[model samples]
Target: MPTPSKISVVTERGQVSIPAQLRKELSLEKGQQLLWEKTGEHEIRVTVLPERKPRGAMAMLGFAKRFRQTRRTEDWMAELREGEK
Candidate 1:
């Protein structure tokens, strides 16, 4: 497997610098398209794809179902509050 890229955040703005090695590996260029999504409270997912669509709808739906199935009502309330912030 290829090694994951090391990335750094920009201090002045809420931007991140993707490592050169990873860019080259992914064939990313200055104007290449990318998608950014907040995967968790402390982590953001950045993916380079021509179309900014999730890989599979079924997987996403299944994940949502599993999440709802696992969470308590209080947990759902806490998540809603977190999103408001």
Candidate 2:
């Protein structure tokens, strides 16, 4: 089934309000960033970029320290490969 389209009027300042239904459906939050691109002479596309989260080695620092390895690497690999036999 085709989804019905929603429309919004552009304001004098060129700002348009995203319809509440679409916003809720898309899970858009305040301060979310969107990318707008012109695909054709009269067509444009809007994409919602995934929310940015703090991610990097720094963010993962000390994460592995919380758990201790109980077995050697070789033992673990052998155990994993045993199922392949």
Question: Which of the numbered candidates is closest to the native, going by highest lDDT?
Answer: 2
Model 1 lDDT, residue 44, Cα: 77
Q: Per-residue error at 84 for model 1, in Å? A: 78
| lDDT of predicted model 1 | 0.77
Runs in model 2 deviating more than 4 A are 55-85
For model 2, how does the per-residue alpha-carbon lDDT over 1-85 read when each residue is reduced to its tens digit? 5447988899999998998987888899999999999999988899999987678877787788789778899998999899889
lDDT of 2 at 63: 83
In candidate 1, position 71 carries an lDDT of 61
In candidate 1, which residue pairs get closer than 3 Å at backbone N, Cα or C atoms, i.e. clash? none
> What does candidate 1's lDDT look like per residue over 65-85, in tens digits?
655566688999999999999
What is the Cα-based TM-score of model 2? Answer: 0.60
TM-score of 1: 0.50
User: Cα deviation of 67 in candidate 2 (Å)?
Assistant: 18
